[model samples]
Target: MQQTKEQYNTGTATAKQPSHEADQSKTQRLRDKKVGDLMVNKRRLVEVPYTATLAHTMNALVANKVLAVPVAAPPGQWIGAGGSMIVEADKQTGTVRKHYIGLATMLDILAHIAGTEDQLMDEGVNDGFDLDQKMSVPVSTIIGQCLEGLSLWTLNPNTSIVDCMEVFSKGIHRALVPVDSHMDNVAGVELVESASSYRMLTQMDVLKFLKEHASSGSELDGILSRTVSDLGVVTERVFAITDRTKVIDAIKCMRIALLNAVPIVRSSDADNEEDHKQLVNGFGREVIGTFSATDLRGCHFATLKTWLPMSALDYTETVFANPLLASIASNTAGPTSRELVVCQSDTPLGQVIDKVVTKQVHRVWVVDQQGLLKGLISLTDIIRVTRFAIVAEPNP
Candidate 1:
């Protein structure tokens, strides 16, 4: 049947069209927001100068709870105090020229001065040494050697929660350094915790996951894989090595990566050469021993050194993944498992739980008196046990 517009009643039905303004608004909400929109300004920033004493720097760190600080050189002028240290015979004059050396950090000063208080005192430096004298060197001297460059990764203020999921998936530290597009000195920063998504998840979303999956009670003893802290696995003895080592020298890789411990197996034997000045593996490469960052940390000199052991920083190598452990821990459902938490055997479960909560850690390893691993308890184990208790309740 042929029908006219009037016969089809097309005139009576008006098609609803999407409001362009509304769609645009939605699109804008998801677009990358600029760091300038959300970064905390410099007035609120924590800044330490190159001349800052170790005592003052540590105080600032403790007060602000920050590990790294940008140290800039104090603008200085060239002085011809005694003319240049060099003698230009033809010119009959020496000129001391000054140039900007860039930034330095606490890590820098420590490297220049190694050894602990006792060692330094034994060497006649005295206890309660004056930090000003010890760390007074120009910031430029440490540049490239220690504090050459700093990188900052920024996300827009309006970036969606889904987009940031992967950023927080690992222990990348929620605090982000803020800077201009030119990558100049930092202007401000946006702490990851300040994002709206974090709050949204905390109040509206996390509880839902917990209600569905988490257990009400804690489980101190749970089955899990052996970790570096495990007894079967060795701890303590470690040898530090450079990153550029042969594949056959996997132990060297372990040392550089700062694992618990490793054997320093050479890639090839150096028996053929008489001088043996250079040790080479079978693959014609130098091999070194396996080393752990922990070994360095144990040394009294580590803390005083400008380049402190990586272990001193409060960062998790692993993150939470399976909020429910009995089922999905080993699968792709939970956080990335890398950092392992170690504690003494007599330490209370409450303390362990505190570490899990504050550090956002995934598992806890209880160690015996000899620093050997006892067992592990995953956050999932705690949640699963709690979940079972909650679900088994009779019609409450």
Candidate 2:
């Protein structure tokens, strides 16, 4: 008995489709969506000024509840400014209307406050933490100082989803999409700007969009249905800290590893004798909670005044002590607290996507049935998988 042409077309043709053509087909099916589709509520500028004092900057961040903000430079404030500084130009004016020099994060401020630069005060070497002086430092002074590797990417509203995925897949955590520009939908991004025209585009934004499209489009169904373990997206090599770790230690570890956040585990099977005796490995550990730079959102000018006149050692010991969870709990007046996001390795990729999108978390910790963390799946991993669609076993 021979198979009929219709039966072969329905079954064999789809299964045997060339992976290259299939990937291209998947890209084509969802390319219609544009960056502009992601909503920008109003045209008002939401960025912090380059000249704004860290005191004002901290307040702005806490008030806005944003982890980071774009540091916009006015044309005249280029005195002793480092680098060309103008990374992007307006499409309409062909000149920068409000130049965004670099980005500033809460981590940058907290790191500097914690003596990252460690300089002697003018009064005396022992007179540490000139709180007033430190708080009054301009935003421009520390914009690009603390986290040197942090980058800012610009995307036009006309950019395609595939291109955006490629950009994000390269491990870029932040991007600015210049909205209110008359878009010409070519394959490339051309950012147009007017006075006070700017908007943030996060990986979550695109991931949510992709999820919506993947739910409707049949092309991604086969890929999305696979387990994360099969997709090889779970990163086994991860950095984390224990709940017993101090707040200052957490900040220091995160800073050294160039990590924005780290998981709070109960224990770590780490050797203390290693030269690089900082980072806590959470593999097979019990994850309690997580800490990130954003958790320092509550520490601002008003809050700093209460802890005035404390030495660096005393300040750290008093505030940055053990049981990291209680020190930064939301109910208290110190930080915005922590969140725990987790999933099993065998969980479906589609379900993982749903979990991340719904929770609005940066990554999901991969755990065993007994609730021990095995690995993690970050947005970069998801984007990499989506960009390549490679199906392979998790690396050993």
Candidate 3:
């Protein structure tokens, strides 16, 4: 439980800046900072060879605990990116010490596995997809299948934070920030850069930056200081499940909804909970856990022999006995495990940003003071606020 601070420590850090920058407005200060500022103290890029298999790439991502990575091609090699989602390479254009093949992720791997032949229940027919052959293919083919809605953006060090916010707000989850890169402009885009080094900046990075600076009388302090309800981010149309819900059933629900995660509750009684219609504050909230798409990352292809059938149109009855919370214990140490985090409607928007970033989650369930679910605050919501408050706000 986080104890509410008596007051936000706002407007204190401004005095510490250099005298020349002391009088800058929030917009000017943001414009002065570049995308590269987010890369400060960040590790150099983590990459896999262009020829890496899906299994090898998955191992690299698990070891690094990263969700996505840029596939690297050897120097002077133009990657043949036929099925790739992020490859924007044109042979006559850019050169680099190491060329980027494309970005790959755990979700892409999962999405591929989900489509395995006979992955659906065929009313007891036994023919199934060959998970082994599927795992043996090159990983680059699968990297961006799940991110069709997002544009894979490549940004230079000099691009402003204001521009980056607009990018993320438009549904691009991450950007590849090239370091020490140079390229020629062709067809309205920079064709190449000497970018052997790269850093991936994500929505989390921006959220962390805002969490640290927004309340210090930064441009967004006014909006961030408002209660979450005031910001209209406490969405009421959220889908949730009970602690007793079967694990397989829960996963299917989220998968169908295309949700990264769903909130879990302990209370079965509807009368005691907040109304989905009114959006009013109430007590006795009982959010006990969360089930995320990431949790299934631990399911190896071999293990999916049993896991996939239960996900079919006619799921297995036996697996229904496995409760979601009961399974959480074994997963706490895995890549998919997450903590149960909740907040009230009146919680400051800045505080929600802190929780979402610090907890490494995309959404934070908004509970009544008593800890049951009412609505949710997702990274998209927070980013939308940042877009309106900082990127679109008028200067003082």
Q: Rate the local accuracy (lDDT) of all candidates.
A: 0.31, 0.63, 0.59
Best-matching candidate per lDDT: 2
> Could you give candidate 3's per-residue lDDT for residues 177-217 as a string of tens digits?
76555442311112234454567788888877666555354
In terms of lDDT, model 3 sits at 0.59
Model 3 residue runs over 4 Å out of place are 1-28, 73-101, 116-131, 148-150, 183-194, 240-257, 265-287, 296-338, 369-372, 392-396
True-structure RMSD, every candidate: 20.2, 10.1, 8.2
Clashes of each: 24, 0, 9
Error of 2 at 89 (Å): 8.1
lDDT of 2 by residue, 83-132 (tens): 42433346666575566667788878866665554232222224444678
Which predicted model would earn the best TM-score?
Answer: 2
Q: What is the TM-score ranking, best to worst? A: 2, 3, 1
Q: CA lDDT of 90 in candidate 2?
A: 64
Model 3 misses residue 333 by how many Å? Answer: 12
lDDT of 1 by residue, 81-122 (tens): 111111111112312122122323334334444323434433
The residue-level lDDT of candidate 1 at 50 comes to: 53
TM-scores across all candidates? 0.32, 0.72, 0.69
